[model samples]
Target chain A: MERQPVQRISKRALTLWRIYGGIQFSILLLISIGLVVATVLWEWPWWITAVAAALLLIDAVVFIWIVPGLRWKRWRYEVTEQDIDLQYGIFIITRTLVPMVRVQHVDTEQGPLLRKFKLSTISISTAATIHKIPALDEREAERLRQSISSLARVAEDDV
Target chain B: MYEPKRLHPISSVINFVKTLKDAALPLLLVFVLNGNIFSGDVDWIPLLIWIGVLFLVLISGVIRWLRFSYWMEEGELRIEYGFIFRKKRYIPVDRIQSLDFSEGIFHRPLNLVKVSVETAGSTGSQNAEAELTAIRREEAKELETLIFQEKSGYVSTGEEADDADIEAAQSPREKVYGMDMKDIVLMAITSGGAGVVLSGVIAFFSQIMDNLPIGKIYDEILDWIQIGVLVVAFTAFVVLLIAYAISIVLTIFRYANFAVYLEADDLIITRGWLEKKQMTIPINRIQGIRIDENLIRQPMGYASVTLISAGGSVLKNDEHQLRMLPMIKKNEIQKVLKMILSDYQMVDEFKQPPSRSKYRYMIRHSWLGFLAAVPVSIFFFPYGLLSISAGIFLVFLGGMAYRDAGWNAYDTQLTLRSRIIIKQTYLMKKHRVQAASGIQTLFQKRADLSSVKLTLTSGGGAAVAQCHYLEEKDVSHILNWYLSSRREEKPAES
Candidate 1:
């Protein structure tokens, strides 16, 4: 709708999402292994192990392989002096517009993992809602937070 | 007005009652846990502790009342409170939005009123802004006038100017709307309050059941199974009827003599029979208006209008007051709304979804019902076939929803109408929209269908207005409308 937001997030965000997905897939892998061990110990149906293996395969492909790339492809955002436009979501594309005048504040946050990846997430807050743009380059996130906040202050419109 | 003043002496009593109300549950627990007093096996220790706690609570209420003092100093309302912690709050007069006045039974006979300071700064806070439990009516009026004059940059010129200012302040407020007896009765009868009361009654009964010898009763009930079924069903019906009656009476009490008035820039709503309430909402603070028509009311051609305001404290204590025109004939909404908020116009025609979206709506609404029907049909067999009727009804409702769901952008205002159970139409100005979004799922993308949503700031949170399964172009049109307005505002700003 309205030609999705013009700017794309940092390219490394793709690798970051895949890494996050990999961690989740590894957790599921361990769980499936536990199920296989239980199947062996209890002499459970062989199909139980088969189901667990099939689940692990599906999770590995969907989460670690397919979803991250698609998500990275979908994520897009653009900030103008007047408004902030965001378009994201893989299967369900959502395009949002937040007028700069309504923005209350802006913040850039980076956790341990994000810090290691040199990525930061910037959140734009209005009086009633919060919009977050995740996995931007750390410097870009900082710049965006400062620019958005200054623009918000200059906008000076009250609810 | 500058002197640090205490509330009326009756405030101590009001404080005592308020504290006791909050402690009622724990006190009841203590009483119930203590051995049966009727059996003369009462435990003296818990009883003594209870009495001591009650006494302490009473004393603390008095101390709290005694310690509380409020004064206006250097363009701010300064409030000093707390018996031990000694809390102090200074609210700038500029941020003080409005003063809400209400009269409880305690305040009524004594010619006193409770004052709640509604401030712009109270957003996201659970507690309401500063409250004066009980104050003289005249003092409250004077306080309001002082705040008003200070806010408006007018200096009071002794007693004569003060009197004149109060008169100016009390100048005839145009009576915009009033609910008649018939409409109030109809609104109460059709309200969803009965369901809430019925649930409460069931909860209370469950609590009572927990203390009863249910196993014995169950065995006895089983022995009389056939007759017991009829008796239980009849009793349940009677309980429902009773709950419904109680809710109707309560609604009537709450909405008795409800009226709306327009004074300068504020819309004042006053209602209630037992405890009177008066709330003032600045016209500018209103973000949007939501008209709700539940299944019953819609069929009856009735609807309720609620103002989405930006004041957090306005949401506290009986938000029913915010329902500006609680119940009016659907057609009459425009007439009354014109008097209060002339900027909003009712758009009778809307861009309805394409005919192809009808089945989608039906599937969306009835999928869960139909899903449940499968298990019911399997478990109950022949009788369970009737469960299919519920799913059919939902499907029918879904078709109606598809027909009802529509969106219209008229000038600077956007109206989005949608329904699940309660049909709601939100009328919002372009400037008030905090965010707008267009959403398209994989299936909808293939079908060239999308949903459009807009968010408006309401009280401490946000209210979303959405119309689903619209043509993709229609969704884009709304997004463009929202975006274009921002561009339009830019030229004016420069």
Candidate 2:
């Protein structure tokens, strides 16, 4: 039997993800400060305290400067006859594949942050793990859901 | 046909009494702790309080005994229970995974048995989905037979028909495999005592440390001991390790009589020393099978088989699934696998995805443990250097663990192999997998990678057999295989 060629899907909303990174970086900065304060309260060495502070600064810089740029560069997905493929990476390129036949269920969720941005996250669950694609517009997420469900139903075998 | 019968009305009261008895040890410990804290002298008030609580509990037990009622109607098992807020649970006969009948030495003379019915639903409740505290042995057997017949898709014939089915089902007791005295001895000899002793030592030291003054005195003693303490501590650690090994061996010997047997379609594992336990796992609901060989077992040519099921709420220490076979010869693996999967071939080796450097990402990410450990360990331990050394060891192990994790797939079969100290390889078939998911974190997207995880439903729970950080192409290929199979037109057979 002839097998159909695999197709790729665009993982848009990379721009929105860059914004999320800034928020996360701010949270990390607060956490780093908390750690430093905890170390002082515990009467640990002052140098160790300095190290914690330095680490926090480094983390903050990565999130604000490097992370947004990296997010913009990475994030895309594709669909083929047999499976769904997602590829994203800034420095270290990584790809993940999910076979349609193995999909147990699919869900679409919108957080307050994403809702404000008019975006939704598409979640696909298999037996062992759950996968998600973040920051898609409602129309795009709906379309993806319908296509994936139809594909999953088509691939299901009578065992 | 054996018709369903109601349990004796007093069964619920008996169940409540059993629960109270089980709680006695903990309750006593709590009372002792409270007495110590209060430093009371000849406290009659505490004794009076205990008496009052016991009297209340006895009254509640009696009320429950009067309220509980259960009966089998058609193919459904109905249980009505509760004292103030009455609750009823209706279970379909087919949904019953196993109907276990157990009788303790005390109950044996009375001809009473405890019937525990395990179901697949996860209600997050410890109470057996359905339990009859005390029933006649014959009646329990009759109920078990009826449930089994219903699960097997056979029509129930009232009492007479049921008798015939029971006769057919009852295989010779001699044919069943059970632990003898010798087997228990061997198990004890092989199971080292190191784990038990180490846990005990840790617990003892932690208790001592908790009570000790942590201010200046503790620091002075720790500092004075630090120079020569590492060597002495190391020697003491080694001795404790040896003691642990011996204890494990003793424990295994005590439990050596362990044996598993096939009774019809059920797998029965019976073992224990002072307190004996017999657990049964039904074959049909078994989701996945795992074969494990520790360094000792591997050399001994023995392997343990665990069955991942959907219903077992309790997790075994050795493995997550129900241990169907504690110890069996390696050669017997294929035969046992065949019994589980009659039609499928046992694939020993299969093609795995080409190595991806993404593993390095996992290794790097694991250093985050050191991030948490460094601060906490330094504050808690007076021997800060030793704590730091332990943290380094953790980071090294974490990196190796990430690198050791790998996945392989062939046709409709996939196997995930991982190891740190103990090796575990999960084998699953495509049809057995209930779900598949692909995930991409913000960082993974930048790395051009996504993680894929596959799950299979087992007896009482689900087993995630394979997880990997794979290239997008490979992930798509696997996903396509799963999706394409779903499209194929075929008659459904369950």
Q: Estimate, for each residue in B329-425, the C-alpha lDDT of model 2 and write its tens digit.
A: 7677677666544543445563343365435534554566567667777787665545555556655654544555566667666666654444466
Listed in order, each prediction's TM-score against the native is 0.93, 0.71
Q: Model 2: DockQ against the native?
A: 0.18
- What does candidate 1's lDDT look like per residue over A1-159, in tens digits? 457678888988878888888899889889988998998899999998888889888988998889988988899999999889999999898989998887887888998889989999998878778899999999999989888878885333246
lDDT (C-alpha, whole model) for all candidates: 0.87, 0.61
lDDT of 1 by residue, B92-180 (tens): 78788899999999999999999999877423334337988999998888888888887888756453345666787666899999999
Q: Lowest lDDT 10-mer window, candidate 2 chain B?
A: B312-321
lDDT of 2 at B378: 72
Q: Report the CAPRI category for model 2.
A: incorrect
TM-score of chain B of each: 0.93, 0.74
Q: Across residues A31-71, which tens digit of lDDT does each residue of candidate 2 receive?
A: 77787787779986778767767876787677656765665
Q: C-alpha displacement of B408 in model 2, angstroms?
A: 5.8
Quote the lDDT for A25 in model 1.
87
Error of 1 at A158 (Å): 3.9
